[model samples]
Every structure is written in structure tokens, then in C-alpha cells.
Target: MMKKNYITAFDGLRAVGVLAVIAYHLYPQTVQGGYLGVVLFFVLSGYLITDLLSREYRKNQTIDLKGFYLRRFKRLMPLLVTVFLVTSLYLTAFQPNMLNQMRMSFVSALLSFYNWWQIAKGGSYFANLMAEAPFKHVYSLAIEAQFYMIWPVILLLAFKLIKRRSLLIFSLLLISILSGLEMALLYQPGQDPTRVYYGTDTRLFSLLIGASAALAFPSQDQRLAKLVRARQKGLNRLFLLAMLLMLASLIYLSGQSDVIYRGGMFSFSLLSALLIVLSTQANLYLTRFLSNPLFRYLGERSYGLYLWQMPVFTLFELKFPGATGSWLVLLELILLLGLTEIFYRLVEKPARSVKWQSFKEKGRVFFATPATIGKAVGISSFYTLAFIGIFAMIGIFQAPDLSYAQETIAAQLSQNQTKEKLGQASMSQETIETLSQQYEVSSQVFVQEEPIAIVGDSMIAMTYDHLRQAFPTAYIDGIIGRSGEHGVPMLEETLAQIPDAKKVVISLGINTDGPVILNRNTIDQMMSVLADKEVYWMTINLSQSQYTWTDQVNAELQAASQTYDNFHLIDWYQATIGQESAYLAEDMTHPNQAGQVLYTKMILEALAQ
Candidate 1:
């Protein structure tokens, strides 16, 4: 294959993809669809990798699988190792709270299977994205690395088995469609789509789409030169169309959108493929704009930016804790750029240019010079601290994981579910009426259906045991990650199937930071469907210091409680105020064991009133 042409436009595209991701991370509400940047990345990787393989085949009549794998290793590993070391050191030294979740991510990242590791853990990328850990970004890199490992071999086999390139490309496209179908089939609507989102199998369609484009529109012709170039004017128009569509998708798509699971991912990838082809030859207008000096600079350092942005933002937020504003964002960006530049110069670029022998010679030369001993010590110190991070991980590898808390909550919830399913009360209605009267409730309410049914998010699951004791007949429809948008529908469905469910307690408003409009709309939606039934909604206990949107959510709940006659406010926020340490978990969101009892007691008292 001929030496590949250096296309400046490709760098601009890299800038767009990475910058979009950075913007999304910095202000998720402002750029909800920016994660589509990762999708774009997958498309780019597939196209370039497939093109590289096709070129190798044309040049030598065979793909050099061993050389391909080695090149991939060199390209990917050094920076990854540096990232692991640096992040490990930072977490161990400054953010020990993150060590538990991140240690496994380290192992998975090193092994090149972090994507599957995330799915196996069942963590939702879209839920509770409070940055408890920073390595989630690595999962996308894992998928790409996995592709680099496997795709070349597949291409080699196909090259031999299928003589015609067009036929082989068609077969790849068919396989890509199958991958998309698998994602669509496996995804469960209104549930955490993380399994599909994190699965390589589901995401492969995006990459394969790009690969198909590359094989179909081979960059290197059989004569080992450029493919027949599209006319500049036509290419410019096409580039404009492609860029516009890509930007629109980036601005509008959401990670949790059902459309993405269904053919939307493929659609975006196809557009990405078109953009890649258009960018193969720089455009007169839009491509020039995209490939300007600033964008090109960012593109050159984009890999470093991608590597460093997550942790820098996460740790910055942790340190400042609820910091916001354009100024704050600018500060974060400046810090990020500075760090990325350093990383590119010191770790990533050097790794690309120098092999082990060169590195060893450089090290020996530096160590031999007394004048350079200070620099050598600084370098040695970094490695020493990185090793300390390694040992720190080993020490905590068997420590109680986040799942321990979930397991305890799960046990209680499971018991509550079992007792509720049996349809038996712990005591007769006479005892219930007596207790109701003791709490100043009218005994007349005993004539109605079961005293209270519950619909909630994870908080309900955490407190279900005490709830069961309080009202054994209470029907609970609590699920983790259940936002009001999803939980209300779930509650309605469950209530429809049950014998009697009235006077419900809704325990939503915690799973997300309310975009105020969405919050009010969700409250209105829940209340509208649940009309003619008594409803009590709980105020979330989130502190403004943690979630800035907490105040907005509580205000909406309070407003809705006044707007509808049957709607009532539980006032958990007021009840639990100033007692977070004793009542709340370390997260200061969910209740502790003692808080669970208090939570149930308050609900009983509210209902009695």
C-alpha cells in the first residue's frame, strides 16, 4: 500500500468528537447528546483500521497479523499503563473513597475487557453519574482495543475465503446488521439499558459499519495509490451535510434513548462513515474551518485529552464540591489542557517514538549525569508512587465492595416482597385500626383498602424491611434507578394488576437532578394518571452542596402537593434535616439502618394525620 495521505480534516473531526465529550462531562445538562462523540469515535476506528488492513492486503497480498497485533500493542499500551499508574496514585493518595469501585476497573482495563467487566457488574453508565469513580471512560477504549485485536484476523480469513472484495464487504454489512438486531432484541424498554450500552456485541455494528465503508471505498487502490477522488465541489457539499447531521445528533441524542438501541446507532455510524470519506480530501470551506490551527492543535492532543479529562473533572468536582459557573468550567478546561499537554509530551508522544531500547539508553544517560540527577529523582519518584498505588489496590482488593450495601438492602427488600406476595397481613384490621387511632387516625379508614401502597426508587428498597413491619400488606414497587418518569408507569401497571391499591406513597425524586421543567411535568403526569386516589410524595433529602438541583426538585414536589387536593407532601427533607450523619449513609442520600426505622415511622405518622 502507498503511504497514507495526511488528511488535516480527520484531525478536525477528532477535535469535534473529543471536545463534545469534554463539554458533556463539564456540563451534562447543556450537552446531553455529546456522548454520541464516543459513537463517532467507534465509527472512526472501524474505518481507519479496516482501511489499514485493506491496504496491507493490497500491498503484500496478505495481512501481517503478528505485526498488526504488535503495532496495536505499542500504540495502545504505554499510555494506558501510565493512566492506570497515575490514576491509581491519585485515588490512593487523595480519594480513597473511590478505590473500591476503581480497583476492578484497573484490572479490567489492563486485561482489555473493561467493557464486559462493566456489563458483568451491571452498572448503568447513565445513572447516578456523580463520578464516584473515573475509569468508566476506559470501557469505550476497551471495545476499540478488542476490535483491533480481532478485526484484522477476520479480515485475513475473509480475504482468503471470499475472493471478491465487494462480496466480503456485503457480508460485513450483514454481520453489522445482525449486531444491531441483537442490541434491539436484548434491550428492555424503561430499564437500565447499560447491558446493551456496555456490550461490545451491541456496539460492534457501529465499528463494522465504518469497516464496511472502508472496504467498499478503499482509500488505497489496487495500484497502491489514492482511490478515485470525489470532485472537490461535490465533496464539500457532502461534508457540510455530514457535519450538520453529526452535530445535530450530538446535540439531541441521549444515552438512555430507546431509539439509539434500535437502528439509531447504525444510522449515526453510517453518517460518520460518510463524513470520513468526505474528509479523505479536505473541503474548500467547512473542512478548512474544521481543520484550522486551533482545532488541529486539539486534534493532535486529542488522545491525551480523552485520557485525562474524566479524572481531572471528577477530582476537581470532588475537591470543590458543587462548584459551577462558566468561570469554573473555564478553569477546569485550562487545567485539563495543561495536563493533557504534559501527558502528551512526557508519556504518550515519547512512547510512540521510542521503543524499550531507546528508553533504557535515555534512562541510563540521565542517571549517569549528576547535573540531571534531580530530574532522574523526579521521574523515579513518579514510578515509585505509581507502584505504591499498585500495592494500595492489592490491599483493598478484598475489601467490602459497594454491593455489600446493596446485598443488605436486597435481603430486606426480598423478604418484604415475599411477605407482600403471600397477601397476608401481620395483624388483623382491628389491630391496624387500633394502631391508627393511637396515632390519631380515624378508625373509619380501616374500612378502605390496605392502608397504604408504596412506589419508589432505591430508597424504598433500602427501607422496605421496616416498611413491611409498619404495613405488611403495603404493595411496594421499588426498583433501583427508578426515576419518576419510569417509576410512575411501573406503579400504574402494578396497581392495575393488584386487588386494591389506594392511598399511595411515592418515593421518587432522587434518581436524577431535576431539569425543573421535566420535574414539574413528571409530577403533573404522575398526579394526572393517579387522580381520585390519595397520594403522598416525599421531598428528597439531597443537599445543595452535593446535587445543585435538589432544591428545584423539592420545590416542585411541594408545589404539586398544594396544586392537587389529594396530593400531600411527606416532608422527609424537613424531618431528616440536620441529622444526616446519624440518619443518612455516607452518600448523604439514602438512609442508614436507624434512618430506615425513622423513615417508616414518619410515613406512618404522616398517613395517620
Candidate 2:
């Protein structure tokens, strides 16, 4: 029997990676950079797969192509298929609205091109994540699967073409750098980076780094392992430093920032590679730290943990939109562990290790035995329900005629086709929705005839018609995907056009990228723009406040309201405090059609003296 070459520390690393990803998805405010964990996994996958293949080649002078392919199928497909089935079961039984997206997800994942499919379909990764696509997590898995399919042949070719291992490693690193450059070149600031993010070519940096590291550092290199053991203290310090840096990246790295696309992730992949290389030492302190029982267990089952995360989170938030707390987290943890166990016990372990020959004899014996009939019947019933779920999923439509967001965009486009564009500001009539015909909203409403100007993000767009109706003659400019910094330019433009405007209704910060709304600098800028004019800055009413910088924005608004006399903070947050169900759309951010009317009402009522 061959002595198994396993790096214990890798499991610990996996545990850390999965935890980061989970935190990012569950509580993004707390772990903004948690998405970097996916890059770490990319590196690890490249290293492990390459190392295994390379070792086999070194030992036998050729790789067993059949065994490699078969083993990979056994290792990956069972759990992948299982997750789809179980999730399909749940969705088919309860959430038919999600059926369309789920059906598309099933097809994409099965084809092993989910990442490319997302890119092709022009789905914003962050937006889709917010949209609660259960299979959004499949992008990374798809990339990894793509690598698995094509890389072995590429590596084999490289092995034949290059005489020296060092040259091959250098080539891998060079390719990795080129991949990073591709990402940087393709990335556009202030737009969704999902194209580059989901591209296999753009995301090749980390995987190539792992491949290079695997070539340079193999677990069974006794001499290298001994040298690491000899220089334990110094290497351990370096390892600790790398670990800390990775954690810091997980804590602070913003996914949409130029820094990430340019080289933030690329640099972090190098650090991950360094840690992976250091971990190859069998008896290193890094190994000791990572190989603990808790770390090992979590790492061993990390794939299942990762698979269950998005689906569970999506379902939880779907059931209770904007509902979040420690209790929710605890409940998610319970559900994740339970579901993972089911996947692991029934599918993952058996598929990976079970032999068909042994199972054939066992099956015959089991069917012959009377006692086994009850167990067999139970198993049959479970699969029958699972199959029904699969058929139900197939019956589900591909996607809705137009999603709510898409419908909004289409409406804006159709309206634009008929109307002439506005002057200077150049906003279309569709965007402005100027209701020239005067409307009355009771005599008691203050600031209705105050030459009000409203400028904001998507929330403003969602409530545009009602805002127009509520405050006739108000200059309203609300474009989707605009943030606070984006709001500043619009605010300036609004003031440029409507100079004598009395009250400025600003709605932003839900999808803030730059400085939050109503913060000190933002207030100073707003003050400079309009010195004493009453500024009715509405608080953000986001369902999942964890994902966006809503807390910071709302906190600043509350403080600014108390500090500045003329800054009359519109307490939309308070108005919809416990009325999320009544006010919020299913997205939990925008107001529903009826809620939009109430939304404008609150703004009218909250307009301070």
C-alpha cells in the first residue's frame, strides 16, 4: 500500500477559508473582504490537484489518465448532484417563485460552466447574491471544475515540453500574473465587476499560483520537510504573518474596489501560496495549529459547509426578508450542519470510497434478506420523492418574462423612446417624471410648494412616480445604482438647475461604495451646496442591512439631524421601523407599489420645520 501524502494544515486552512466566505455572505458588514476566501480555495485546489498528479507522474513516470478522471468524478459529482437534488426538493415543495432561477441554475451547474453562464447572462455577482440566487455559490465550483477538466492535459503537455521543473513553475507564475493583468484591464470602476469576477481566464491567477507552489513544494520531499523542521522558528513566524495578512484581507477587503481587481487578490494569492508551501512541512508549528480536532473536522467537511451556505442563507432571508440576528445565525448554523451531514453520510463518503463490486454482492444479499426489505423500502421512498422534485424542477420555467429590476429598466427604456432628453443635466423625461400638473396632498403638508428637489439612488427610482405625484413641480432625478458620492454630483446638478430650491430630499446610501450619506464630510459638502436650506435626508430602509453600509449611513443621518439645525433628517427608517412587511417589496429594499404611496406620505409628514 502507498503511504498517503496528506498535509494536515490544509484542512485547517480550508476551515478558515469557508468561515470567511460564510461570514461574508451572512454578515458582510463584519467581514467585507470575506470573498477573498474563494481565491484562497482556488489556490489550494490548484496546488492539491497539481501536487497529486505530479507525484503520480514522478513515481510511475506517467499519469494514469483513466484513474485520474474516474477518481475526480467520484470525488466531485456525487455531492454536487446531491445538493441540486435536495435543494430542488425544497424549492419544488415550497418556493415556486424561485423555480425559474433554480431551473437555470440546475442546467448551468450540470454543464460545468456555471461561472461562464453567469458572465454570459450578464448577472451581477453582488446583485445576484442580493437577489438570493441559491446557486450563486456554484460560480467558484464551476471554475474549479473547469480547471479540473482542462488543466491535467495542459500540465501533461507542459511536463513533456519543459525539461526542468523550475521552468514549468516559473511559467505557471507568469501565466498567473498575466491573468491578473487581464482582470485589471477588464475591470471598470463604478460598474458591476461580475464579468471579470466570473471569467475563468480572469480568475486564473490564484489557481496558477497554487500550481506553481505545488511544483516547488511537495509534501513527500523529505529533504525540504527536514530543512523546514530545522528552521522551524523562523518559518513559523513567517507563516503566522501570512495567516494574519489573510485574516486582515478577509476583514477589510471590499469586493468591488479597484484594489481587489488590480492586484489585491493577486497579492493575497501569493501570501496564500506562501502559507501552503510552508504547510508542506510535516511537523511544522503551522501543521500543529491547523491539525487540531475542530479545525480538522471543519476542514474535512468544508465543501459541504460551503455548498449549504448560500442556499440556506437565501432560504432563511426569503422566509424572513431583512430578518437578521444572532438567533438567525445560530439557526443557519444548525440547518447547515444537519444538511451537510445528510449529504456527507449518504453521498460524499460512499461515492468517494465505496466500490461497485462490493456493493453489487451486498445489494444481492440485502434484497434476499427479509429484514432488509423495510430499509430498502425506506430508501426507495426517499429517492422517489427526490426524483419527483427533479421532475418538478424540470417543469419550472427558465426565468420570469422580466424580473422586477429588468421590468423597471425596460419601462425606463420604453418611456425614453417617446420623450426628448432633458437639457444640460441630460436626464431623460423617464428619469425626471416631472408632474407639471399641480396636485394637492392636503393643506397641512409643509414644504410641498417649497421648490423641492429630490436626488437619490434606486430607492428614489422605485418611488419616482409617487414622489412626482406627492410633490408636484419638484425636480426629481433618481437613477439606479447611484451611491452617496454619485448622489453628490446629482445633488450639485439639481442645485445648478433648481437654484432657489427650498428643501432638498436626498435618498441614498443603500448601495454606498464611497463615503456614506450624511457623514461629516458629506454634510460639509451638502452644507457648502446649500448653507441653511432645510435638508431632508432620508434614512436607509434596507432589509438586509448587513450587506450594505446602511448602519453607518443611518447612524450618520441620525447624528447629523441632532447636530445641524437646518438638516431636517427625514426618519424613513423610523417610519418603516417595524413595518418592513407592509412597506418593503420582496427585495426588502424598495417599497412595493402600494408602499410607494405610503413612502411619499412619510416623507411629507417627516418634513421638519
Candidate 3:
């Protein structure tokens, strides 16, 4: 195996892949095809690793397994660990909700088993939520490492078993076909293909394709080299066309669907291989263009850029969630590249050069030797035993009084049933009689009369039980609807369902700015439906998490309330302004149980008047 010089077009392809992934992360819908970068990485890894192994075999008549692992460990571990540590620190300080996930991600990443861990969790590499895992980028590294672990032994065996290159090709094809069939079979419908996408078995085909390319064109033969050079101009144009196709496919497919291979990966990998082959020849225009100092610089730092980009982007989004417009996104991209370059120089480059003398060198131990072999088997056995033991304990503990425990939980939940009936009694006698005639009155309905209709999103949904308690006989019909669209459309929809409904209570604005004006068309429509009915327009609750727009919107809503005679604007803003603890959920959006009770009480008081 001869050492072929670095191909400039390949470096250019690497740059293309890196940029696509970055753009996709910055603006997901716009750059959906960016996911193909992973496939591109797989193919590139396959080609490079195969070439390295071939070179080692030719030079020393054997693969330097120890040196290979050492180089890989040294190259990948420092940057990965640094990112993981940073993510851990961030989660510890800011995102307590994601701490569990961060811990699991860190452990999986440290072990170079993130691919398997992600698969087990049923999460995609490109999923929006994966930003929580700072080291999710390492799934590719895990796949590559798993491949390396198996490839050396397989290559050694192949060297002994096969004389003809055709035999090696046949073996590769057989493995690829079998692995692909398994991948297809394992793919679950409707579930995210995170497992299939990251699994070593499924992704092996990409690597094998690269290996095939290596085998098919060993060292550049003189006739082939001349032929490639002679057709460089036409080939360069074709390469340019292919690159365009790759970009177009990425953008178009991402917008259309999330099916990874169909959208971008398949086309990108094939095109990348062709570009790699063409770049082997000297004086090629495509090669010259790709070999530019800037493109090469980006390609060199691509790994670091990929590692740091997501965490940086996530923090940016957290700080300025409203800066989601195209120009701002572009600014983030520029900032990411600049920051990545700095990190590469200051952190990654320095870490790579620093040797870990603490790592004790162990000489080549046979894969089948008792100590090495037993360690793998023992670890596997221990895990299997541990899983069974945990499950067995759970089964035994649950087996005795599972039904009783369920009943206990059910009984506890039913405790509120009594309170809800008391709240329903707060409704007027006329409204209670009307509701009882329409729907089956539950035994929980207390013998009091009240009339109110509560409506909003999930915030209102959680509060329904407590609301029923506050106004026992109040004809409380809480309908969950989105904010901004809340006022008239929701009221009309609920009124139409219960035509004889008297009092309409609005409790929305969690998902939208409170000051935003009600849709006039919807308002007119509601006024038309409820021409003679009394409507109590509840003022939007002031969240402790105040935004400038929200303040403005609340003021506008307050002004609108004065225009309608039937609408009695209850100023919840004044009452609940500083009382965040009353309404805010852990996510700081929905009202908790206590908040629901407070809100229900306010609405009941207005209806009572």
C-alpha cells in the first residue's frame, strides 16, 4: 500500500459536510439535509481507516493495533471529555430538568457507548432535544470506535483466508447485504429511526462502500492517473453539479421529510466517494479549488466545530430565544465558526499534544486469552444478571399487592371528587338544572348552585378539579384551547356544545401575549352567538416571567374589555401580578394546583356578583 497525498476535493467535501450540519443546527427546517453529514463522516471514516490499516499492513506485515487504539484515544478523548464537563457544569447551574439526561449522556459518552445509549432511549442524533446532551456528537465517534474494535481482527483473518481481492470484495458485500436486511427489519414504523440511524450494524454499509472504493482502486495506476487528468475539466464540472445536487437535496428533503437516508445521506455519501476518487489526480481544477487555504482550514477544524456548535447554539437560544430570525441565525453561525476556531487553537489543539503519562502501557494481549476474554464475558454476564435481578425484585415486590396498590392510588385520586362536587354547587340553580338535564350529573355535584365556564390550555386543564371545588354548583365547563386564539372562537365552540350556557369565563394567555387584541372576527362571531348572554372576560393573568410584548398585549386586552357592555373585565393582572408562586409550574408556564384554586376563586367571585 503506497501513501497517497491528501485529496483537496475530499477536504472540500469535508467542509461542505461540516457547514451543512452547522446550518441545519442553526435553523433546522431550513437545513434539514444537514443530517447527511453523519453519513458523509461514516464514509470518510471507512475510507481513511481502511487506507491507514492497508498502509500499516504493507509497511510492517501486520496492523499496529496498540498504536492505532492509542492514536484514536488521544485524538478523540480530550475534546469529548472537555465538552462533557462543560455541559455538566451548565446543567448543574441552569437546567435542573435536564440533569438526569445530562448525567446519562456523560456516562455513555465517556465509555464511547453513546450510540447504543441513544438507541436505547429512542432519540435521534438530530432531534431538537438532543442539545441537552453536550456530547451527543460523539455517537459517530462511538460507531467508528466499535467498527475499529472489530475491523482489526476481521482484517487479520481476511489476510490469512483470502489470496484474491475478489474474495475480500465478496465478503464485504455479503456482510453489507446481511447487515442491511437486519437494519430494515429492525426499523420500527412511526418511531424515530434513532436506533437504526446510529447503530453500528445499520451504518456499516456506508463504511463498507468506502472500503470497496479503496479495494477497487488500490494505488493510482499510471493509465488511470493519466485518464483522470485528461478528463479533469469535465469531471470537475460533474463534481460541481454533484455538490449542487447534494445541497439542493439537503434543503429540499429536510423541508419535506425527516427520513434520513432518503432525504440526503444516500446521495451525499455517493457523491463524496466520487469526489474523493477524482481528487487523487494532480492538476485537477476541482482539487485546486477545494485545496484553498480557507476551505482546508475549515476542514481541519471541522471536528471541533461540530463538537462545540450545538452547546453554543443551545446557550444562544436560551439567552435570546426571540433571535430566531434568519439574520440573527446567520450571525450565530459566524459567531460559532469564529468561536470554534478559537477553541480549536486554545483548547483542542493543546489537549491533543498533551500526553497522558498516567495511562499504563499494556503489550498486545490475544483477544481470546483468558484475562482479556474473561473480562468481556464477565462484564456482559454481570450486566445480564443485574438486569434480571432488578426485574425479579420489581416483579416480586409488585406481585403481592399490585391490585391493592393500584386501588390505593385510585382512592387517593378520588379524594378530589368530593371537593369538585362542592365547587359545582356554587353555580346558580337555573344553570345547575340545565347542566344536569344535558349531561349525567356525577354524585360529586354538591347541592349548591353556581354558573361559570372556564377555558384555556393545559394550564386550565390541570386546574379543572380545583376549579370545580371552588364553585361546586357553578356550571364550570373548562375547554382547553391555545392562547391568542382563545377569546371568541373557543367561547363559541364551547357555547355551541352547551347552547343553554349562561356565564362564560375566559382563562387563557399562557401561550400568547395577554395584551394582544382578540380577533375582531371571532369577537363579532361570539357576540352574535351570545347576543343576550352575560360574558365575564377574565383579565389575562400576569406571569412573573414578564416579557415586554406580554405587558403591551395585556394593556390592549384591558382596553378592549371596556368596549363591551356584556363583558365584565375581571382585572386578574392586578390581583396576581406579583403572585408568581400561585400559578407558575416548574416550567414556569402552566398553573400548578394551588394557582388553579386561586384562579377558580377569582372567577367564582365575579360570577357571584
lDDT of 3: 0.58
lDDT of 3 by residue, 1-609 (tens): 112455555666678778887776665546756767767777777777776677678678788888777777767776676565555455445643434345456557767788886665444443222223345667888888788777877876776678887879778867766666666666653334556778888878777766765665543536657776678677768767876777786666552233443323444556666666655555666667777778788887888788888677666655564355767777777877876775565446654554445222543222112232365664564455345445433332332222233223223222322223113234566765654443334323434243455554434555657665445545444322244544555666666655666776665544431112334444555666666777776555434332223454455556556767777766667766677666654333345556565665566566667
Error of 3 at 513 (Å): 22
Instruction: Record all residue pairs in model 1 with backbone atoms less than 3 Å apart, i.e. clashing.
Output: none
Candidate with the greatest lDDT versus the true structure: 2
Highest TM-score model number: 1
Q: Using alpha carbons, what is the TM-score of model 3?
A: 0.60
Give candidate 1 misplaced runs (Cα > 4 Å): 1-4, 129-132, 221-231, 360-453, 461-479, 482-504, 513-535, 539-598
Q: Report clashes for each candidate as comma-separated counts.
A: 0, 0, 29
| lDDT for residue 572 in candidate 2, whole number 0-100 | 75
Candidate scoring better on lDDT of 1 and 3: 1
Q: Give the CA lDDT, 0 to 100, for residue 84 in model 2.
A: 76
Model 1 agreement with the true structure over 1-609: per-residue lDDT tens digits: 011456677778899999889877775566767888888889888988888888888779899888777677767776776666676677666766566555566678878898886665545565552333467788889999889888898888888889988898888899999999999999877556777888999999999988988887765333212332435566667678888888888877866578988988889888988887656654257756867888889988888789888778767766664456678878889998998876666556655554556556765321122232366664674566456657765634643355545435434433343334223566677787765654344554343345467777767777776666567766766666667557556767766756366688888877653221227777887887778678888888776223444666788888887789999998888978888888887556778887886787677766766
lDDT, each prediction:
0.71, 0.72, 0.58
Error of 2 at 338 (Å): 1.3
Off by over 4 Å in 3: 1-4, 91-98, 124-133, 219-223, 255-264, 325-327, 351-609
